[model samples]
Target: MQRGLSRSSSLPATSELGDALRACRGAFLGVGLMSCMINLLYLTGSFFMLEVYDRVLPSRSVPTLIGLIILAGGLYIAQGVLDLLRGRILVRIGTSLDEAMSARVFQTVVRLPLQSGGRGEGVLPLRDLDNIRSFLSGAGPSALFDLPWLPLYLAICFAFHAMLGLTALVGAVLLVLLTVLTEFMTRSPARQASGLAAQRSELAIASRRNAEVVVAMGMAGRLTRRWAGANASYLAGNQRTSDVAGGLGAVAKVMRMMLQSAVLGVGAYLVIHQEATAGIIIAGSILSARALAPVDLAIANWKGFVAARQSWHRLNGLLRAMPAPTSPMQLQNPSQKLAVENLSVAPPGEPRVTVSEISFVLQAGQGLGIIGPSGSGKSSLLRALVGVWRPVRGHVRLDAAALDQWSSDDLGRHIGYLPQDVELFAGSIAQNICRFDPEAKSDGVIAAARQAGVHELIVTMRDGYDTEIGEHGGVLSAGQAQRIALARALYGDPFLIVLDEPNSNLDTEGDEALTRAVRVARARGAIVIVVAHRPIGIEGVDMLLVLKDGRMQAFGPKETVLAQVLQRPAAAPIKIVSDGGVSKP
Candidate 1:
């Protein structure tokens, strides 16, 4: 299981996303330029009305009127073309942003379990990325881009008349204030709604995943009520935000419409007083409407803007907290020298340690059996050994190098692990046996199956190695899934194998297969550690490690530990001596 040269060195820490945005700066610039031209051309309609009223009609020249109409049509066509170009540029920018961030977001999701020790939802990051992409391509950002040109339109209004300009400016300021009010009123409630929505989603997912249990236990009504409570909370928060934003939006719309009419009224008064011409009166009304268009649009889409902003902050914070990928040292594959020094591990998000100050060492070709009652930190220790759970203190080393020093992908190739609850992904039997390695060879897959003693049983299926396993291997029996998971752990002849309850679902034949697999792995110069409750599961193990209440009880050759355990009084607490010895109470 040799790895290729390190590719992580080429990946920048948080700069790739920045670089992607920078790459699109030119495109956004082009969009801005097009928007400027589009806004400038928007005056064509006002100008057309002005010339027809003031010049064409008075002059009574059909040629002048026809020429103005043709020129206005050409300007409208140019504006349409620029509008289309800018829209296309925004769409391309959105696509480019997705292309740049999607892969990295997916990578982060895949590594989340390892980084957080199996806590957190993996799908949320992708959802956040999608939110960002949608916002970038949508009408919301287009309105923001046009917003800066509002002043230019108001200037055009001022050139028409000072009273018209003042009316438009006051209207714009009021709408801007309304926009701010919408944000202030809805921000907290919107954030609350988003969080509640996520919680409701997770709850629904959990309920669906355990639908069978809920049905068998007759918990449908209770679970439904529970879900309903969460949904109601989500709806309440959503409604509050919508009410505030919608109310402000309606007021802003009314204000803009009234302001447009008010501009026309003011311009008419100015015209009557001979302060402005009839053409300027009509032009002022049109320009005033144009100035407030972007503000209206921004208010209409305020909720979407808030959602995208929150998603951006969340995604940025998550990515920033993630450790930067490092170029792993080109270390040779370990030859089964495993060492755990003063290791302590706690559950994720919990302060209490599950396994504490445990230490051990094993050389190549040795097999150790760990036996303990439930909740004795058996599985926790195994997780630490396989690099699934990082140590809270101290370290686990392979061949004298800390496990954290290796790239996860490279290290996974040399280590095999089977958790207490075996789970097989949705795929063919061959794929699961090969650990889903796309480049796995057929021979290697079959060899691993044979090593796990499930080759003959697998052949009995109609599709043999190609048989499709349903989700979580639901199509298979408990014993069948356990054996297949063992085969997966034994795949690629990994130097270090950690198995938790490998024979919990096995029968007589399956138990014999388990023993044979362990013996073969040991003979091939691998370090094997099995966590079991049954004595038969430890048949060929050369050493034994006993744990009780998160502390080591005994660890030595299998025969010596077994003898010591056998001699202890059955009803009394086993006394642990300071010199790694055990005595009866």
Candidate 2:
């Protein structure tokens, strides 16, 4: 019953990173203006030297010398103030960027696993955002901003003498060439190193998380070797990048020093020829060095620059691939009726469908049990129903409105879902049960825990509902985690409840509690769907949907479908000998 999707003519969208950058355009402009003022004030030292040597010393006027010193001190103070303001502005810009993009990046990270079928990683986006922020507030970007003033410094040198200006210009061009060469040599290896580093970090984190398994299985040595291999590759790539950049940096430093000396020598010649004064000679040397300083600083910080650039590209790509956020519609809460039409789902990054042409309808005050053998798509169907996974074709609607049409926050309020593998965040029992709602009522949280039959268990704990659950609820046992997760799903008495193997970790009492919880949910007129494998698991369900090999094998009232399946002829038996040989009968 599934249908193919239709193609649309819309072009791809831009990234939130771009939007954030545009929003900060005003701040950047202010920073640029600050840079202009700072660079202008940078002339204070050279001019002070010129005034002292050219005017005060010749006139032997102590008052003039003192006044010049005071003026120079005031200019220096102004330069310091401007520098401080520019630094503060950059910090603000970085903070603003984070404020704008952090929430969106976090949302994308959470959604990526579903969109890409569990193939996406979350840490990289967060890491990229941090990298961008650090670079903005670091010295690298300031170096770039100051780079534009290099030509102005050269012009000041030219005003001193043509030879001095030529020396400064040649030196600037040489340093610029070195910077370009540094980029060309290190670009590929730097990129490779960054990718390898991320892989190493991921592996290390995984190993730490599964340390018990590694220790119990005596896999420490093997895993260590694997990590070492990846680490070595990363180190090699990093060393290659560093070697090239370092070599160029050394050459640039030497060339800058030689340029300063050459400027001094040329200025001295001009002074001897009576074309320039002693003050002009010193001033020319200072301006020439200033002209080349930004280039040298840029070369020295090339690694940071490359890393930030790569991070920017990655974040931009991730944001671009993400769907734009839609304004939340003022839609009313959906009624408990649920419908699935020709639904099909495929695993992420794979073309083969896992579940196909699934169609069903369930109204309020009814419960359905999905029974299937291993690999029968039962869990996949439940996931699709609850909006955890997107269907390849067709629609899942609640009260005739498509699930995608509802805002997630609004839909979440009306839907409750518990997966087979349960997880609880690090918080108190009450917080987890109440879905961490800041405004959750105490009575409501207690009611949910009571409905799940874990209220007695909570009372026995040292702090009752206020007891903290450690990371992933590691402080609690398997049964405790499962029951707590059930309480979380039953919170607020949601209209649509989907549970996948809710009693998988429960004992006899727990199982009874689960049955009662389902009955209670049905009594409240909720649409309940349970995925199960055992007969007892489906005891209270009114309808049955049996799946086999991704197709619907049977669907109807539980007794009718059960009777039909039971009456069908069973498969022929095979005769087996004591030697383990089997004969078809």
Candidate 3:
């Protein structure tokens, strides 16, 4: 939900489809030449078979006939071998295309305007990539090969008899039109079904991911209903698409049967009139069938072609929408003297600002605590400070420079942040701590771990610092995970530290230890900001700010706020709650 890399800039328009096909000149020429060779092989084999049928006279030479048979066999084998080689080449092309497209997609995502990133990360492109897979692998190349076959089959028919060939050619054209019409009828419905399926998958993924939360909240029945609804909608869309496509198929079948019947009747009349021979009739039938090959392929792959086109367009759109970053601000010393002037932030997916007109500052070697009730804008304030969500009205500055003016890399290098929920990769304990700076060495990693209060716990593990944690640090206890995340934040010696609910799940001892680490961060000249309703050992902070209903209720030194709390017995319990929530026996 944070303002990710700035999205102020756009990518070039021409970058959408990738470089033009002409730019890949060699690949296009290779594909075209290979297709021609394949068609030539097929035509040669067809003619060779036709010769055998024509020379059925009893006076034919046996040796010459056998030689012709051998020649035909060779052409068949050559065609098959070339096809095998071409298939391998197609695989390479498809893989290259996927890699190239994915690279562009990622680059565009990184470059896209920050506002569009969240919405753009949805399902269509991946589905489209799947479509691209089918196309580049077989469908696209087959369509290319069909281009040559259509003309060749027509030419062969013309050679036998101009009128008969013309009739077949007209039928071929009609078949193409029918195929296209059928595809058009199904295209919208198929796209709708595909979109519904994508949404269902996203729901399923989100549900699976929050399995623990669902179980804890006992929302199993609700989740099941939601999933069922998505699936039902998806199935309904799919059925509609299938029905339309099926109807088109039925129509095409009737047309094909009627056309073939007419062709046979015409051939019979020509033969009786002594205008054509039996062999010519048979050859014409074969040509007609050959001409239908591409038509059939096109009809069969309608869904795939539509999916691929949509995927291409979606990916192109995302890439084109990526935003460019602004120029980096010049910070002479780059120390953290964080300040917020009339800060405001609206929660994601909602229009209302949760924290409005809130302002505070934290200088080097100082710490500030933000305390508030649930939904009282405590977390929103930290998010604003960290540059996650931009304020609707005000501004945030670090060392007198606007947050927007800093480069993303520079901001990341200087500011360390830990969200309420921590995420860790699958790696050794040391690796997770030194995520960005891998060359930090064992000593540097261990020192940071010590500062975060996890060094001793790590040594107790079988692998010591080398212990491998599962996904998102699943192997560690919650407290251990928190400390490890703290170590990650402390790894690069950042200038400012933003901790969101760091002590929410920690026990009393863990809370005290975390507080000590925050103090250590302050000693390192970091401007430390802690957001928590329950302070958990923040008594020694330089300042305390209370937020309620999106406005600052109190802001000043801890003593002054503590005195205000004591004056009102109703609010006086905050100190005890702030001190690690310890209960009296």
Candidate 4:
């Protein structure tokens, strides 16, 4: 009963594989029909030979025999052509499925919430992608195509002799058992191997990122040692999986030989007893071996299936984990007005909210400067307003509508957000800025770059905005990359702009230019919110909000908050008015 319950609980093992096959079910059906036709032809030819041996040969009807041979040749040629067409169609189907599954996996990875710590760097992503690819490419469809062949082969075996048919049936059952056992035994190690592979991929990425630093510090030897250690661990894990799989395969080999010998021996005894003819027994033996062929192929490729299954689950889990938009509430058209009410922002795996019960608002044409010490939740507050972190206890709004009511795509279109880390892709600069918006013309892109103070730099490039920038804008300076990223945000002319420490990497001239851009945006009736740890050029603007110890310590105009915090004695720590319950003086 426990075993039955366990089997029931396992994700309908057929679903993922079935879905993949059904994606190209037409080609699969064609292959099946052709296989059946081939088998029928073979059976007819076999019976023809049997009749010739029993009657035609004794009668010496050479003309009839020759005609039968010619007919058999024609059938054989027709079967070959059909088989070839089926194989070509099947290959096309497999290729299409591979491309589709790979695309799905890639899309899923990109949509997953960013992971922090060491978890994000390792082999998890690659393993998932490779698993999905391998499944669709071969392991999945191979098993699917075998399903129709199994019963068909069984029927053919049964028609030859009852005893041989019974023996073949038993052999098939044992072969399936062996394959399942092999799959079960190798599954755990394959998971470990996949995990190790993920880790290796992450390490390689990290090592590349730190390559320049290592070389500058003359620590190449040390870095190499660390990399070697990681590789060694990955190799060891892979070998363990291979060892288990190889061991199980050896055992299955022995079992298959024993089972086949037993079937042949039984068939021989039946022939001696005249229970079946020589041709019948011969055909039965061949059919029994053929029946086991699919099982053997399945067993040999079980590792790929296990890997793919793990990947499929990984992708499913990713989609499951994304937060749904707030239910039933509707924000059909978002506006520029941004408000955060009694908001609490918490990072992943954190017990305490970083910013608690904080409330602020940014009206159109209003620019607010958020200033605090490091780790004061200034950036956290910005993230919350942008819907990156949905508040635990309170609501966020845009134009009096709940922020959660808006879908991610709609939210992005309405609000322009630039995180501290400026990431660029390996593509032409214009492509990176416009992203999926193909209608963004060259003039629009150049104008955006000019507004972000990056036009001069872009024009200097050999191909202007068409020039390719390597991964993460490796060819550009920190300030240049930040400016280009800002241009990307500005390309859409979003009504609400949220900038987190935008001036940190800029020189004095660049900082002033960015300040001018913000002023220009404000002039255009856009709301701008800037989160900065230090004094910024945007300091003398409108309102200020200070957060500390997860509570709003002060909220008012910039002068009011700064003056109140500065009134404390020279040696004493600055103290601003807190919400009373959540913080201490």
Cα lDDT tens digits, model 3, 1-585, are: 000001111224355345532244566567667777877776764565466656643347687678888887898898788777777766666676666666555545443323542554554555566566566677645664565578778888788787668878877878889877976787689779878888898889888879889989999889999999999999999998877776766666666666666656666778899897766666677666666666766666665665566665666566555533555655655675887898888865468889988766778988888777788988878877887677788899888887787777678778889888888888888898887465677777887888878888889999998899988788898888988888888877788888888886678767777788888888889877787757564744677887778888777777676566658577433332232332321
Flag clash pairs in model 4.
122-198, 123-198, 123-199
In terms of lDDT, which candidate is stronger, 1 or 3? 1
Q: Which candidate is the best by lDDT?
A: 1
Question: Clashes per prediction?
Answer: 0, 0, 11, 3
Clashing pairs in 1: none
* Candidate 4: tens digits of C-alpha lDDT, residues 246-350: 776676667667666776787679779987665565566556666666676667666666666676666545534543234354465554677788788886445
lDDT on C-alpha atoms for all candidate structures? 0.86, 0.84, 0.71, 0.69
Global local distance difference test of model 2 = 0.84
The regions of model 3 sitting more than 4 angstroms off are 1-13, 20-25, 55-59, 103-124, 216-218, 246-269, 324-333, 436-440, 564-585
Worst 10 residues of 4 by lDDT: 1-10
Encode model 1's per-residue lDDT on 6-39: one tens digit a residue.
Answer: 1111233344455566678788778878888999
Against the correct fold, how does model 1 do in TM-score? 0.92
The candidate maximizing TM-score is 2
Q: Model 2, 1-585: lDDT tens per residue?
A: 000000011212344666676688788888889889988888988888888889989999999999998998999999899889888888888888899989989999988888887667647988888987887887776788899999999998888778889999999999999999998898899999988998898889889888889999999999999999999999999999999889999999999999999988998898889999899888888888888988999999887777777787787777778865676675787766898899998776678888989877888988999887899898888888888787889899999988888878888888889999898999999999999999999999999999899999999999999999988898899999999999999999998999999989999888888899999999989988998877777887898887877877677778776775677577732121111332321
Instruction: Please report, as a residue range, the 10-residue window in candidate 1 with the lowest summed lDDT.
Output: 1-10
Worst 10 residues of 3 by lDDT: 1-10
Question: Order of candidates by TM-score, top first?
Answer: 2, 1, 3, 4
TM-score of each: 0.92, 0.93, 0.84, 0.83
Give candidate 4 misplaced runs (Cα > 4 Å).
Answer: 1-9, 12-35, 38-71, 74-107, 114-130, 147-163, 166-170, 217-223, 247-276, 323-336, 534-536, 570-585
Ordered list by lDDT, greatest first? 1, 2, 3, 4
